[model samples]
Target: MASSFHQFLLLLCCSVWYLTHISQSQSSPLPNALLLPITKDATTLQYVTKILHGTPLVPVNLVVNLGGPLLWTDCSSRFASSSSRSIPSRSIKCSREKAHDLGTKRTTCPSSAQPCEVSTENGITRMATRGELVEDIVAVGSIAGSKATVDQFVFSCAPTFLLNGLASGAKGMMGLGRTPIALPSQISTALGTQQKFTICLSSSDGILVSDQGPHDSVFGPEISRSVTYTPLFSLQEHSIGVKSIKINGNRLSLNASLLSSNGGTKLSTIVPYTTMESTIYATFIKAYIQAAASMNMTRVASVAPFGLCFSSKGIDSKQLSLKVPAIDLVLQSEMVKWRILGRNSMVRVNDEVMCLGFLDGGLNPMTSIVLGGYQLEDIVLQFDLGTSMLGFSPSLLMWERSCSDFKFDSWPKYSL
Candidate 1:
């Protein structure tokens, strides 16, 4: 009896050890990887993420600009940081210094008298005054799981007036563009990881993941799955190659030349919904309306910014998704396609109205097709600079998972 009891206890101990080891291994990714939780402002519909910024570390909310020039914050009001004493902007002429960035510039933020000219992906121009330039510690990743810190992180401090059009809580912007000063480049260098970043924006909340790994997430031990790659047209713009678009397996008749042209299709976090040129929008809307009618979906009066709206009476509450037709963005070849199902293709404007989530950018839009944030939610996208490729996955909802389900969290309190 004594021998048998000892044997049972040993087996339980070994089992406990094995379980603990497995948990640790699954939570920690190979080499380096950090996840930053992001949020979407209901009023603005823009995705923003938080970070521990400055000395004495205060929470700062920043708008994620996938192609913006640099990471900037508004330090105009009630901005108190012991580390904000160093002045680097004017000495480095940051406004004129577009390319060269050391990634570690200690400085103080002084109010600027001049407002800098800033441009958006949608071809809108805005005036922004450059504030102070400072380098301090910035933390990313979840406090619960894992966190990575940059010892000497640098970012610009701008005036509060620049926060006019940003998400409700966002003070400024965090750039992930070609500039060396952007978050991707700085984090890539600081962590000694790959020169890439992955984005998985969810509705109201999301994540900004950097470095490389098949990260263990709430979706299981693999955050990277069902991923398909298409060559990136440009890193600066995060542009991708598109052969064509199909509505419910039926191809929309469009100018093939437009798909292969210079400014063909772009991925944007700025715009709320996908925007197309006048010709493309008209063609897409016509095909979608026809497809809806065939499905017996009710068409209601058009809403502002949305040319097509439908009644929720058409939606079958059961069986998961709406009966709407799927959209396929054929990329690289016919085999590789990004599928847009009901969750991504439709937006509930109200209890009675369900609007087709797309926009028309008048006649001459900068890029022919600007894929916006709404469609980007519940999908995983990797902007891999290492291979000049744009990797994407189909809707996560198909697996009964959301990108929001991925492991991520943040510090609760923040200032400005």
Candidate 2:
């Protein structure tokens, strides 16, 4: 019976040792491939292949040659960098909180006959102006003539960088034969990876002779009336495990499959946004410019030459011939709906409604239009004659388009 008890005790001790070894193996991090080579150099340190699963392991202490057990620590614990990133930047003034804070007295505003003097220099002084003040407001309207057309092209990244490194590929065609558009990097960065983007053409798709050379280089058959946008790069969203790509003005989230490339996983996915007709219009502005010029030749009632004065001071008046481009814009037939939201006491129209008004030609030489008594919810005004306009909301005069319906025949041209 004593001999049996001794054998049981010995077995129990062996079992305890085995269990303790197994528990330690489960708790400890996996060692590096070369850590236990059994012939490691005395001065070499063992490096782990993977990070431990729990909180960062406490840094081991090392001794200095001149000191007795000099202390060393991993700064990764106390001074580790964080993932949070924020930058102060100028964003669109869309928030109402910012607008209301700009305190301007109501009584000091303009009356009917006399234009109000606004505080210009320091908000203490004022400058009197004619008519009323205008504010920036956006609305959907039909475009006609050359303005209705747009050109779309995927510019090579090389040309894009040469013109302006900061500008996205959208503005690649701008300033081809003209002074280059001075695009700073800030503008490009502000357009954070756009899923898509749109660029407005300042020129038409036609041949013209300037001091430089032939303008025909910018025109092509592939140029369509719809807006053009190109995708550049992509990023992976950690939360969704999905990849996203930036095109001109849109973003496309996509699911991707990982495949092995060079023995490593290569993540690949399809682009979200595709070039479609309904989403884009490809046309040149020159087509409309020619149409408008042709209409002007037939519709002009009288031709008049007048002397334009440079200034009220020393400059002499120069004789200039001006042709007024007039069109019998179908008022009832060509009307677009204008919806405006009012504030304080400015609401004029309710909800969305049709605004049946003709766009008349303005006296400006370049291009201008006059809208007669057209009322939207946020905008209402009567016009006499001038370029600057005002709105009922914030009292500031602004130079804005008076016409909407833009028509186009074909795609416009552009150069890079």
Candidate 3:
């Protein structure tokens, strides 16, 4: 099975390469010019940027998070006293009006306390304390290179963080949500540009973020177009509208109503970078397993965390390729269909075993789909809050592309 899967992936790659080559010859230039290096730390992807909290600048590693809106960093005494470049913590009176304006769920500022405790919806129990909203310079891309700086940026300075499942090396997270305090909005306001950012994740190389141009430029004739846009359901969580899911070409009789937002349930679809398996409704998983079984795929013993496993020992790569079926995510937009490639769906455990890179998300009533990083491999995702749309395209960069080529300080400059 492993050999067959590998062969299938190779065939798909060849076909895509041929198609991309032909398209590139006829198509215009790509809109994305500024490509910064991204580091893959285990399952999570991080982007490095310099933050000017004080006089001197400090290099901070931040995880690229799209689910939350607030940007914060650990403000422990060790971190603060280690470098003079660290932003100083200040106490400020909490305002009820401001708290109400920002919404209760976001603002953890107590009615009387100077230091605010903020909690994030990272699906974890971690909490971060906010010292005060300080004005600092945030440099994206590189410190010495053609980087964009957002001066007087209002971000929380959390002195401490109780984190789990996150890289300890990371100082904080760069929030890409649509809120006023989000990195995208702050950067857009500072640069006087549209609130837009692009994320390109690959199997080998990590994640790349690029500032997107105007809507006219993006959809115009001047820019080389490789992206397809779909209207975002909500900017708060960067949710996309998924209509249905299919195994190969056959559409499962899954309840579309369960996937829609109603009442207090906000059924969102997010692409998470910290996990390998895409979590879906348990019912959907059953349907998927049935589909695979129909294709003569032999089910093996269940692995921890994953419900489906298959024996791949002694199986020819080409044979596995011919046996496995394709999975397609049908979006709300009829014109767009995201087909899950082989490399994105299967994971090889050992020399003789492989498992589906998808899991049953339980029978929770909440409608949410977390598309894991594995599924997002080699895909470019563009979040455009200005146009209220999400764009996707095949990553132009190859998996074998070295991270050293696009180092933060050595990145090539391009005019916006």
Candidate 4:
């Protein structure tokens, strides 16, 4: 039965992958297929026995065939699959029955009638003791590694609102305002700026903020009652790659560290906001900032106020680690995968990471209509570096463009 179940899952996964990401032609809307969590449990747990965990195990070796007006590196590309390999284990478990349909095996509550919400605040999702993601509710999806670059794997799939009270583990979302999904102007009246204030808003699906204040606040306020502005997903900031440009004759670099896990993680750098690296990275960070300047990207000025702080080698090559701020998520990138090296150790490589960060409405403006707001894809990913191997997500590699195979290429063309 175990062998049959495993084989069934493998086949289901293959079918889902091909149907979602591939087609006879490439012009169709980008595929919405996403990564789901797979839980493996041991037969027993001793009083002092080590807890087992599960890590991302994406064995897909995808070769994207990029061709068209789109820039290969610009978040849209095809994916190829590869052979299967085992990843690390953790203290996650599920019923043997739930493991039967591996491809569609989502974490759900014990009732199986209720759904689970992926906790964006801590980058972790709660599952039934059986280790199942509540079907349809909200649950974080697992990824392959400890550290991930959100920019890489964010632009893969489209998220389903699943009004049936179920939302897919998606990527690329953002928090527009405080809670109401209203514009800054509307919220200002309620909170009264410079005053400690809070308002009520609807609960976020996979694309909005999870109001930590109160679930009943929606019916409490008048001005706050009406959700305004259509909840726009605005552009935050843009930065250029340090390697692509030079500052003070030194290659520029942007280092992001998780500052606090309050609403989400606030990524800050070690350098104060007025350094060279910050200037350079910020200069080229925008999607269309280059086109707006009409200047050779290498020659653009590093004048973005947000790029005030810059650091050279902020993160050491030997070992670089940062904390992920606790914030509600919109969605997570699916292309990236991870392996757990440690489980619940709270130490380097032996930590628990549960979530996938994918590109979403925040970066790809086109997805906003469906996502309905600024979205950031954060899924539950379990990882412990103690007994895991390094894995890579296709999204992490630089995007390439070609009429043929769309592998990572050094030079990808862009149109203004």
Number of the top-ranking candidate, with TM-score as the measure: 1
Please report the candidate that would top lDDT against the real structure: 1
Could you tell me the lDDT of residue 373 within candidate 4?
A: 10
Q: What residue pairs clash in candidate 1, if any at all?
A: 86-107, 86-108, 87-107, 87-108, 109-132, 116-128
Candidate 2 whole-model C-alpha lDDT, 0 to 1:
0.18
Question: Which regions of candidate 1 fall more than 4 Å away from where they truly are?
Answer: 1-32, 85-97, 100-125, 128-133, 142-146, 216-218, 221-223, 317-322, 408-416
Can you write out model 4's per-residue Cα lDDT over 86-181, one digit (the tens) per residue?
111221322321222223434543342333212111011211111112111111111111111121111111122211111122121221122221
Off by over 4 Å in 3: 1-36, 43-53, 77-131, 142-144, 212-226, 262-280, 313-323, 365-367, 394-409, 412-416
lDDT of 3 by residue, 213-278 (tens): 332222233222556777776546666666877887778676666655431122111333212112
Assess each prediction's global lDDT (C-alpha) against the native: 0.73, 0.18, 0.54, 0.19
Output the better candidate (2/4) by TM-score.
4
User: RMSDs, each prediction?
Assistant: 6.6, 33.6, 12.8, 25.9
Q: In angstroms, how far off is 47's CA in candidate 4? A: 45
**What is candidate 4's CA lDDT for residue 27?**
30
- lDDT of residue 252 for candidate 2: 26
TM-score of each: 0.81, 0.12, 0.71, 0.17
Model 2, residue 209: displacement in angstroms? 66
Worst ten-residue run, lDDT, model 1?
A: 116-125
- Quote the lDDT for 48 in model 2: 10
Off by over 4 Å in 4: 1-249, 253-403, 406-416
